[model samples]
Target: MLILTLVIVQLPQILRQVQEWRYPRCYAAEVEGWAAAYDLDPLLIYSFIHTESSFDPEAESSVGARGLMQMTEETFYWIKSKIAPDEALNFDSLYDPDCSIRFGAYYLKLCLERYGGDIATAAAAYHSGWGTVDALLENGQYTRDGTILAEFPYTQMAHYVQKILERYQCYTELYGS
Candidate 1:
């Protein structure tokens, strides 16, 4: 009975540790620094990384998104043009943690700013595209206003946004301020 009681008492801590392992803060310096620079929450960035590649810096998607943040060549080049116009770099740089996190954070900053700080809309735009999300917003079916998304148009994208939101919530509950 005493052993069972002790096990019960330790269960919550054990569960929390397991969850922490699942939602790791892998690139702390890069994540925190770039997040801070972009005026974003580190947990949000961590959630993105968790959902994108499970913190795997070498992860690649079937659609050719590469690295921790899973950026595509098109997005990488666009971001590179915006942030490092003169630097001679290629899409492969997205495989580097520093480059991936920095570029990902900048992209998040742009999405958040475009959506007027609405994380859901920004996440949708991230999974889909800003143009697609903008059309959804303009149709008056997904959003009542142009800012908050009432419903996601695509089911897959809805799930993606939901996963990101869920991870963000978990990350907050586990390691938030």
Candidate 2:
């Protein structure tokens, strides 16, 4: 009875943390579709989405990234031109499950191509921008293995990398690779 009480007491925090770390079902389904469409692992897609927005469809970053996939305005516009030119897309559309996931998957496909199918490098590029990744590589600050040393300048990028990794582990455990 004491153990049960203790467990119940800790449940909310645990659940909250899990909520912050996992994608919701609607977002997961969209991610799965995108992964299938692009030949990406669904677990990887989930990890990215989990890290980006914690499955919040209305999420918007300070840098103007929006929705479950946290896509930037420019990328959204580019995707709109290529995929949905006749359809109108605004910040609200970014909160729509299908549009956000499609754009996110498309960007991931682009990154995978750019980074030669290296997930870590591609993810880093996605978070830090390709230019930053390129400059870091050019200056020998990052390696092909995706190892960035402790002295790396961008703490946000580093944290982003770590969060994705952690979320990926959770995704694998929850859904398997």
Candidate 3:
């Protein structure tokens, strides 16, 4: 009777913990379509969104980044013009969940392509900027033989990359396609 009572009391907490460890599919259908369209890993996108804004559609950063992916207006417009020339883009629409995830996936794809498929470097570029990361790599700060360093000189960017990768791995392990 005591064991049953304990199990009943603990079940919800254990389930919540398990769900937390599992991959979060907040915008499931939209994220799925966008991930496929962008050729990005769904888990990576999910982890990125989770880290950037904790899936908050109305999220805004101190630096004026907004929405689920925490994208700045400047970056969003650049990507919008580059990718969707015909699609109308309003600066305020970035706060919308759908737009944010789509834009973020596109930006991630661009980063990956710009960094030659080096996810770590691309992530650094995402957190910092391509120009900064490129300069460092060229000067042998973050990259020596063109491989992205796990132990980067910039502490925040390095930690961000490490955490994202770890969360991505966790998502993949817990719920991979």
Give me the candidate number with maximum lDDT.
1
Error of 2 at 17 (Å): 13
Mind giving the per-residue lDDT tens digits that candidate 2 earns over 50-150?
A: 78887778899999899888988887887788778888777578888788888888888888888777676677878877888777766655564443322
lDDT for residue 97 in candidate 3, whole number 0-100: 82
Q: What's model 1's lDDT at 134?
A: 88
Candidate 3 clashes between residue pairs 3 or more apart in a chain or in different chains: none
Q: Please give each candidate's TM-score.
A: 0.95, 0.77, 0.86
Backbone clash count for every predicted candidate, in the order shown:
0, 0, 0
Weakest lDDT window of 10 consecutive positions for candidate 3: 142-151
lDDT of each: 0.92, 0.77, 0.82
After superposition, candidate 1 runs with Cα above 4 Å error? none
- Give the candidates in order of TM-score, highest first: 1, 3, 2
lDDT of residue 18 for candidate 3: 83
Model 1 lDDT tens row, 1-177 = 999999999999999999989889999999999988888899999999999999889999999999899999999999999999998778888889999999999999999999999899999999998999988988887888877788997898999999999999999999974
**Of the pair 1 and 2, which is ahead by lDDT?**
1
161, model 3: CA deviation in Å?
1.0
TM-score result, candidate 2: 0.77
